[model samples]
Target: MTRPWEILTAATVAGSGLLAGVFFAFSAFVMSGLRRLPEQDGSAAMRSLNVTAQRPPLMIALFGVSVLCVVVIVRAIAGWPRPGAVWLLAGAIVTLVGAVGVTAAINVPLNNRLDAGTVLWSQFLAAWEPANHARTILCLLGCALLSVGTIRWH
Candidate 1:
């Protein structure tokens, strides 16, 4: 009895969860460990990390998942009688804006500044970590919502 919307909603839940785990790793361990490194090493590491993170595969996941979230929202709305449609829509929008959008709008610009030597370590962390944390929470929230929605009426 699994329908197209069911499959798509399940995929959205998985995608959101996977991406959230990545961000959670950064906020929880990677950045803190980077802070413990020597100033020069830390700065160099961050720069390198940012560059490497933009690899095609990772970029695809980061962006592709966001796009899928939008598709899920659209589908959810179009077939409004689906039990968890509203939750799916809310989760998609939240993840799109709070996680993907924040990363693109805020974190990317801050990374650019760090790349250009316009900001120092303390400045970089202060600005970057908070936004990263926010995205992590949002992604996790979205994942939870989607998970619940996926199972609620299935």
Candidate 2:
């Protein structure tokens, strides 16, 4: 039977690959597509991209990576470990959790409001940008830490 750590490592690697390849890439791809849309096609794609970009599909994926990163870090440190290992784990946790909060609390709320049609799309996005940026920063940092974990992991 596979060990629990092996299961977690598999999940983490899977999440890492998905977030890196699919979730984040989907948003980027959509935005790139939006940019390439004919000017007359107007704001539908842009609006959709903004809302789609704010969701936390990547958080679940990154959570798996965080688990694996911790496991690998523990393995690497079996003999001797640097202080940064703890910092890396802690930071990833904070960043990932914060990304979730930023999405659920701020971004999702705004997306709901936008979807409700109470606010104009441009106005909604104007409000959405800051929350979106915060979540993006948190996720990006999580990705960076996870990347470090991937490279440093043995």
Candidate 3:
């Protein structure tokens, strides 16, 4: 039978991986596709996207993963014998600070500016894409760390 920590660690890894994939999709295709459109169209599309992205599924993935990471940290610390606790904790921190923090600080604000028609497409994409890339990297790193933690623990 699987232990509780094992299950929690699995959740952490899976959630982080899911978020990383989402970020990667934005960087790989979504942004690229937006780039091909006229400036007005692209900005309008992105503004719409910002609103649409606040829906349940994406919200769950973005916020839920961070919550999962916290829970994993608690579980890992409580069971101090776990060899991978440190890595799990590190993963949690990375996701919280990099993915969530950056999103809240950089992307959301940029989106708001775009929605208000205060930002140009070049400016929006320039700032937004690089920050998103940072988010992608962090989420991927968190996934990798959590996977390692899971393996070491099990």
Q: What does candidate 1 score on TM?
A: 0.93
For model 2 the local lDDT of residue 61 reads: 57
lDDT of each: 0.85, 0.53, 0.86
The residue-by-residue lDDT of candidate 3 on 1-154, one tens digit each, is 1677667678878888888889899999999999999998988898888889999999998888888888877866876587877877778888777669999999999999898888889999999999999999999998988787777765
lDDT of 1 by residue, 10-96 (tens): 778888888889889999999999999998798899999999999987788788888889898887788678787788888888778
* Candidate 2, position 128, lDDT: 58
List where candidate 2 sits over 4 angstroms from the true fold. Answer: 1-84, 150-154
Query: Candidate 3's error at 131, in angstroms?
Result: 0.5
User: Which parts of model 3 have CA positions greater than 4 angstroms off?
Assistant: none
lDDT of 3 at 96: 77
Residue 80 Cα positional deviation in candidate 3, in Å, after optimal superposition:
4.3
Candidate 1 vs candidate 2, TM-score winner: 1
Model 1 clash number = 0
The reply for model 1, stretches above 4 Å from the true place, is none
The alpha-carbon deviation from the true structure for residue 109 of candidate 2, after best TM-score superposition, in angstroms, is: 0.5
Tens digit of lDDT per residue, candidate 2, span 96-144?
4544566678766766766666666556556655565555555566556
